[model samples]
Target: MKFDFHSHILPGIDDGAKDIEESVKLLDDMAADGVDLVVATPHFYCMNMRIDRYLRHRNAAYEKLRPYLKPEHPRIILGGEILFDHSLVGNDKLPYLTMQNTDFLLLEMPYAKLDDQIIRGVEAIVEDRQVKVIIAHIERYLAFTSYKSLCELMNLDVLGQINAESLAHFGTRRNCFKLIEDGYVHIMGTDMHRIERGYASLGKGMDIIRKKFGNDILEEFERNGKMVLKNYSYEQIVG
Candidate 1:
């Protein structure tokens, strides 16, 4: 079964799917595309969301949409697309968003260059031995002239996540393929947002995977997704 580990399917929170109707529609589309499970990863920017409030709203939204969920639709799981913040690392308030009880945390980086502070922040989290960090959408960090810096980060035991859409881009596809080939990337996610832009792009991404990598590669990607659902450690799967 296919699983989309990242999506903004949670309703009325942040920019994704303004209401339940849109959220349900996104689910239907995912189900039709063979996604058996989807993580309702709403944005969890530290600047905006308080931990208790985020959980309360997430639960309420899940409850409101429960009755409408079809048996054939993808199973919804709660998570958040957490933006990186230094305060989040030992803070008891934010641990719930870390891949559902597993040590792995989905960490989003800033769109620009990777700074020393970001590196140290991630190092602090890893050094604590409490969380194994997964750098969400590693492709965005390709602006660096040499991939040595990226390689250095990967050696820290941080897993990389690649967005499906990058596989189809001319400029980015080569690097994505290179990362996949080198085994640096351990997970694939849609990172889907709106139905119009996100859903359509995901479809194209699936096609790109199918055409370029064949079914076996796609199957392996799906297997990693299942591994996440089962809370498997990255060391167990990647090593």
Candidate 2:
């Protein structure tokens, strides 16, 4: 499946799409760009908000946007870009924040330096809770980590997600390609906000990858995305 594993397309939720119209428009662009599914990852901060309260807000926005989505539009899946914090470890309600109510969690780290507690917390979430963590837009956090630290995180068996925007605008093309080629980037997302910025760039960025590598690279992303969905369903069945 051609899946956008990270996105802020939900209306009035965080810094992505503003209203129903924008949400619909973003979905339209996604379909046109050949995206088969969109994981609607609105931002969720673990600092002060209760999980129940956040779900109420997110569900309400999702309900409002639900009516606008066409059947032909890329399928929408419920998830969140959870800003990682130590407090979230072993929280029973954390499962509700996972993708498709499954074990795959879209975890995001802040732009500052990574501390030991955060690393241990992620490990606990995976080992204790049986969750597979996909680090959101990991390229943004490179400055906070040394190459050794990055290798350590990858060694933990966590998947790294890169944004199409980062591939196109953030770093050198060679470095970005190196990340994907070296198996660091398991998936790519537009992380689109509005039509003005990344709506068009998703296709453009994917095209860059295709041109540099080949169709096989794009197919690898499609296969990896399917594994996420498949694993989600498998977790549900075993439970």
Candidate 3:
């Protein structure tokens, strides 16, 4: 149940894995890192990318890697790291974009500013559509807002997904620890793109977690992920 819930492992669709070789390499890294499942979340900016075209590209890339998919490797689940836009407020297709058939959507919020309208848009998606949202790379958005703003955002019914790299590389571990200790962090993702230029680091990130936060922390993250995937009573964990 150790699921890497956000990644760009699909080849040539987005700025993730360049080719099938890189895709397999990323999968190998996931398997070595003890990830039992991975959600291949290529980037999707609704303002620009059309849904039909995105799906077609995604399926094509997925088909290319189908034969190589094996039980021993971390099983791939389809999802998208969607960049938030105001238009998503009432979009019916939003639910269809969730992780596999689950209700969890990996949402990458805007890095520009955290405004009331954007916050309401997120709430609308959850309340109106009944789709659970996981705010992707929560640490990345912290730079645009204050600690109070972050706490307020977490207070919403959605789950906050922090990037593994943020746990070590982003110089945000101190803040990440605060969020974790306060039960604000509900899940973790690698957000891995490529092997070169230091984008692939699922193994390295987990190593840091084990040394810094111990096994219990890792287990809790796994449990939360499993709960979401299984359609369990996620409210218990979210609160």
Once superposed on the true structure, which residue ranges of model 2 sit more than 4 Å away at CA?
A: 170-172, 232-239
Error of 1 at 212 (Å): 3.1
> Number of backbone collisions per candidate, in order?
0, 0, 0
- Candidate 1: tens digits of C-alpha lDDT, residues 140-235: 688753476677666676778888778877988889888877777766777777877856445567677677677786777777777766777766
**Relative to the unseen true structure, what is the C-alpha lDDT of residue 162 in candidate 1, on a scale of 0 to 100?**
83
lDDT of each: 0.75, 0.80, 0.81
> What TM-score fits each model?
0.89, 0.90, 0.92
Q: Would you list the rank order by TM-score, best first?
A: 3, 2, 1
lDDT of 1 at 74: 82
User: Which model, 1 or 3, shows the larger TM-score?
Assistant: 3
Which regions of candidate 1 deviate over 4 angstroms? 143-146, 201-204
* Candidate 2 lDDT, 1-239, residue by residue in tens: 57888898999988899999999999999988878888999999988688888888889999999988888788999889999887888887888888884688899986676766777778888777557788898777776876556666655668788788766764646567877877787788888888666474567778889988898888877777888877743233222
Candidate 2 is scored at a TM of: 0.90
Which candidate model has the greater TM-score, 1 or 2? 2
